[model samples]
Target: MTKILGISAFYHDSAAAIIIDGKIIAAAQEERFSRKKHDPKYPYNAIEFVLNFAKVKLSEIDHIVFFEKPFLKFERILETYVAMAPRGFLQFSKAMPSWLREKLFQKKMLFNLLKKNDINFNEISKISFSEHHLSHAASAFFPSPFEEAIVLTADGVGEWATTTVAVGKKNSLKIKKEIHFPHSLGLLYSAFTYYTGFKVNSGEYKLMGLAPYGDPKYIDLIQKNLIHIKDDGSFRLNQDYFNYTTGLSMTNKKFHNLFGQNPRDSKKDKITQFHMDIASSIQKVTEDIMIKICRSLRKEFNIPNLCLAGGVALNCVANGKILKEKIFENIWIQPAAGDAGGSLGAALAFWYLELNKDREVTNKDRMNGSYLGPSFGNEEIKNKLNNLGAKFEILEEDVLIEKTADDLSKGNAVGWFQGRMEFGPRALGGRSILGDPRSSIMQKNLNLKVKYRESFRPFAPSILRDNVNDWFELNEDSPYMLLVANIKKEKQKQMTEDEKKLFGIEKLNIKRSEIPAVTHVDYSARIQTVSSDTNKKYYDLIKKFKDKTNCPVIVNTSFNVRGEPIVNTPEDAFNCFMGTELDNLVIGNCYLIKKYQNPALKKDYTKNFELD
Candidate 1:
């Protein structure tokens, strides 16, 4: 048997993955184990978990692959600093120590880290590095249910390439073209994310969620000042407006002047019409750029299928727009499209590209529905809950599903934990907080009471796969919740002329659909279509919910408070359940009702986690 271990670390979303003979055995992110959001430390815990899951030792692995070439990335940073010359000395000084002490000698540092696993210096020589974009392309194409497809990857600078185009045919994949760094769609979006008073890497989605509440009034101004686009989607950043190349901050004074305001201090200022308009304008610009690129690529390749990976691919709004425009016959995206997925992609790159192995396609992708993380058994869950002195009831699978669905129907927020945890940023059904979609106050209650997040951000809908079309305009399988679709017109509640005249975030409270909890102000929803093939338990729960309420959809959000990582164990789930306003906790076949829990166990969970 050929065993390969892949590691992506020292960056946000550090992770580890193991593959046996080109088949994925296990994959997980370090944050899930560390209880830190986007933990960048070496993924020792994640690596240990994967090795144990695969029943292998580090010494037995044939190849250990790092997701990106560290030297190449360091070179890009150095050259960028040189280009900026004397203007960014402070930034250069701050960055140089880390590069000199750690990143510049990544090979040595990595070897030292491997020593902790009892792999000696000689054995550590087996390590290999893959190009950043190649890893991303392989992640997108190899696991997809496609024989041949066009792959596009765009992200904040990876080594030197920020965007790349590749084609995958059977077992072989080839890169066709690339747009190098200092100009990137991902960075552009992240810059706006910062400018709009949100965190950069983690706050982009918040910006996307806030877009539907405002008008795209700044689109023309943005197109004129920040980016220059050709007839095709290829574009150049003016550079004068962006400070990411040489400074710690994403945007500069020039950018602030162009936007006509300084960045918002999220803690002090309320989200007004200006920030909402900026968010909407940037979202529209991003969609336009993505659509233009997909159109150009389709005309060039004439391929029927398109595969997408990288952080930007996480923008379901853009993905939905591409689907609406019919840029390709079919689109498949890596559920874990961000840097966390680079571990899996790196391993797949070595298996397919380096070893030149044969390829096999399945009707459903080979991601195991992205549920490739650690799982706990009923005995283990029972022991943890007992140790915590928690109140709970154990029931059969059918009874558990029925009771949980009934609780949801009566307007209870449930922390639903089952099977293996998800490998990506999304919680899927494995670690999710579910609520009834028909409740008009469900969204607001979940946001302020349960999640403690900004009220303007929207929640996603988890719907039965067979009934997806009846609720939303989308007919495609969106198992990963990476696509947004409009609510079916028949299901929508048309707004009156007075309601239509409401501006900015004022439209937020106006109900737009039957499933108002999951519907955005613009009548679109980020949809997850559940299937029995991937998660039978979750599918059954939604089915039971439908039987009770005649609505097949439920509000689904990650199972944690704001700034906390998704709960990984029964203990984490119980803690999160007790911390928030969640009414119940369900793990395996056991259910714990909040009202029955000991009052002494209740603590202020808001103080437990740092806000992002």
Candidate 2:
């Protein structure tokens, strides 16, 4: 058996993954264990976790692969600075010292870091490098169920390539086309995110959520001044309006002037109609570009399946638009499509491309529902709860599901920590905060009291796979919650003339559907279809809820407050339950109610972490 370790570090969302003979064994992110949001360190804790989980010594591993080529990235930076010389001196001078000292000699630095894991591990030749875009493409196509597919990857500049097209057949994958740096759709969307007073990488989703509340009033302005798109879906950015290449900020003075205002200060200024319209315009542009690209790719390749990866693919609204166009017979997106999934991709690329192995396609794909993180047994949960002075009661599996379903019917917010912790951004019932989807005020209450996020932010629905078509317009499987679709016509409530006339957040309180908690202001929902094969406990809980309320959907959000990483252990779960307004705590087979716990354990969670 060949044991290979893959690592992606020195970038946002550092992670580690281990594969044994082409089978994915373990994978996890460093932020979950370090308690930092988007931690970009060496992923020491993540490496330790994967090694321990696989019960293998680092010395015994046959190969170690880093996600990207550092020298290639350095070359892009040097060339970009030279092309815009004297204009980027400030940024160039600041970046030079780090590149010369550490990044330029990544192999030696990596060797030192590996020694910290095991002193006996000293094979420097075992370490190899994979290209950034190739890592992303492999992550998307290798795990998909399709025997052949066209792979599309787009993101903020990686090394030099920002967007790429690859074709994957059986075990062989090859890049066919490339769109290089300084012309990126991901960075374009992020520029709007920064202009709207939100953090760049972390707040792009917030911009997507705010799009439905406003009109696309700036689309023409954006098209004329910011980006130029061709009929074949190839595009370039007007650098005169942007500053990402040579400055610290994303947008420049020309960008602000064209938009008719300066960037909003998130600390002071409020989100008005102007900001909402900006978000709407950018979102529409992104979706249109994605659809055009998909159409062109299908027409050119004549492939029935398409796979997507990279940060831009995380835009579920764009993904839904592609699905609605029927450009391909099927679509598969990487669950961890960001920089974190690069670790897995690096490992898979070596197994199939480097070693020349045969690929075995599975009916359900090979990700195992992305439940590749740590899991605790009943005894571990019991011991940890006791040590934390948590008050709880243990129940049988059937009784536990029934009682949890009963609490949802009573409109109680629940902190559910079950089975294995999920590997990606979305919490697929593994570590989630669930509520009744039928409650009209559940969305508002959870946003303010529990998540402490913006009121306009939307929640996703976790519906049973068999009943997804009955409640939502989508008939395809969306286990990763990466696709957006509208609620069924029969389940929607028609808005009155007065309600329809209301603008901005004025329409927030009006119930738009039978499951108002999960429905966005535009009557659309980010959907997650739960199947018994992937997660039996979550499926059974929803089934029990359906038995009592005749509703097969529930509101599912990550089990964390704003700006914090999801909980990874029993103690983290207890602390979050005590800090937030969640009413019930269900970890493993143990259950705890807030009223039964000591009042002294309550905490001020609002200011616990920096807001994203």
TM-score, every prediction: 0.99, 0.99
lDDT of each prediction vs. the true structure? 0.92, 0.94
> What C-alpha lDDT, on a 0 to 100 scale, does residue 46 get in candidate 2?
93
lDDT per residue as tens, model 1, 1-612:
899999998889999999999999899999989999999999999999999999998888899999999899989988988989887888989988999999988888888897787554357578999888888898999999999999999999799999899999998889999999999999999999999889989999999998887789999888998999887899999899988887889999999998789999888978888888898899999999999999999999999999999999999999999999998999999998999899999999999989999989988899998999999999999999999999999999999999999999999999999999999999899999999999888999999999999887789999999999999999999999999999999999999999999986677788878999998999999999999999999999999999999999999999999999999999889889888899999999889999999989988988878888
Candidate of highest lDDT:
2
Candidate 2 C-alpha RMSD relative to the actual structure:
0.7
State each candidate's clash count. 0, 0
lDDT per residue, candidate 2, 1-612, as tens digits?
999898999979999999999998999999999989899999999999999999999999999989999999999999999999889888999999999999999999999999999999899999999999899999999999999999999999789999999999999999999899899999999999999999998999999999999999999999998999998788999999999999989999999999899999999999999999999999999999988888999999999999999999899999998998899999999999999999999999999999988999877878889998999999999999999999999999999999999999999999999988888789999999999999999999999999999999999999999999999999999999999999999999999998999898878899999999999989999999999999999999999999999999999999999999999999999999999999999999999999999999888876779999
Residue pair clashes in candidate 1: none
Task: Please give the TM-score that candidate 1 achieves against the real structure.
Answer: 0.99
How much is the lDDT of residue 375 in candidate 2? 95
